[model samples]
Target: MFSEQFNVRFYETDALAHVSNTVVAGWFESGREPIFKLFSPNLDLRNWPLILASYKIDFHLQIFYGKPVEVRTYVSRIGNSSFETYQEIWQQNQKVASGNTTLVRFDFSSNKAVPIEAEIKSQLQEHFYPQQESAK
Candidate 1:
């Protein structure tokens, strides 16, 4: 799993003095940056974008400003032209929210879904779960 740590800012807090629900989405997006960088060191996402197909978020606890947060992300499933990722946000060592996102592999030139390349899959696998020999 890939993870990132960040501090909740005052601006991210709502009238309740807790992090806003929308801010959790932004935190999830921030966690995706390193995962995408692993696929291509110099990837220009604007050129070859992975479009979001669907997503779900479950909020468990309230997050407050000045608290340190950690977001963990991992690929849970990979399909022919799409992949699903699971993300969790933690504050004070407790789960604050969890989310899942489905992204479609697209052909920028054609502007449509396309099969994921083998090389790309291999790269993602290496970063998310490196292969290990079975114990005998």
Candidate 2:
């Protein structure tokens, strides 16, 4: 799993004094930088190879300012042309939120999804997470 810490800024809070829901999304995206680097080592936007397919966040507790938030990201699943990242935000030793994001490897020139190459897939496996099996 990849972990990143960030200081909560006052502006990121809402009138209720909790971090805004929208802000958590940005944090999760930032936490994916490591995975992004695997796809684009130099992070060249002009030749970006991945596209965000979808994301979902579930809040467990209110996140407030004055504390650092740690985002833990894991490669939950890797498919032929896409991967899913499971992330969690923790503050003051408590989990504040958890999320999942799906990103597709794309060939922008052809506007189509491309299979993930073996070399890169091997790298991604280093941070893989064992997802729980569904109940019968």
Candidate 3:
């Protein structure tokens, strides 16, 4: 798993004085850039698009402004044309929220889903959960 630290900003807070749910989602997406780069350094978000097919976030605790948070992400499952990412947001060592996202590989030129590349799968396998049995 890879983790990144982010500070809650004043503007990200809602009228209730807590970080908005949308802001938390943005942080999760931002953390994914580096992980995607690990598989393809030249990954062009404009050319090679990965679309979010589904997402779920469970809010455990409220996050306020100025709190230090860590966003940790890992590849939990990889399928023929899609993958699942699991993420958690921790505040002061306590889990504030956890999320799961399903992303589908796409062929930009064809504007349709495509099977995941073998090379990309191999790279992602290196970061797979330790307890997961190796893919067949």
Candidate 4:
């Protein structure tokens, strides 16, 4: 699992003083940065290889500013051209939300989804969900 800590910034809060629902998506994406680097450490900014295909988020608790939020991300499923990322957020030791995103590997030049490379797949396999590891 890849995990990161984030602070609930004042700007991210709304009139009700809760972190905006939209903000959790950014936090989740932030948690994916390290994992993305594992796949493309030398990726060119002008031509990106991965793009988010879809995502779903379920908010279980509200988040407030001035405290740390913990996000944990993991590889859930891998296919020919796409993989699923499962992520969860926690604040004060309680689960704030959980979500998943589907990312597709693409050939920047072709501008279409492409199969995941063998080497990158191998690296992603190392971070598979624990249940997935047990299944194998």
How many pairs collide in each candidate, listed in order? 0, 0, 0, 0
For this target, which candidate reaches the highest lDDT against the unseen true structure?
2
**lDDT of candidate 1 vs native?**
0.81
lDDT of 2 by residue, 4-119 (tens): 99999999999999999999999999999999999999999999999999999999999999899999999888899999999999999999999999999999999999999999
Largest TM-score belongs to which candidate? 2
* TM per prediction: 0.87, 0.95, 0.88, 0.92
Model 1, residue 8: displacement in angstroms? 0.5
Q: Provide the lDDT at 105 for model 4.
A: 90
The digit string of per-residue lDDT tens for model 3 on 1-136 reads 7789998889999999999999978999887876678545798666765888998999999998987899988888999989988888999889999999998887778889998889888877766655564544
**1 or 4, greater by TM-score:** 4
Arranged by TM-score, best first: 2, 4, 3, 1
Cα deviation at 12, candidate 3, in Å, is 0.6
| Candidate 4 displacement at residue 83 in angstroms | 0.4
Provide the RMSD of all predictions against the true structure, rounded to 1 decimal.
3.5, 2.3, 2.3, 1.4
TM-score of decoy 3: 0.88
Summarize candidate 1's per-residue lDDT along 71-103 as a digit string, tens digits: 988777778888877889999989989998888
**Model 1 alpha-carbon drift over 4 Å, by segment:** 127-136
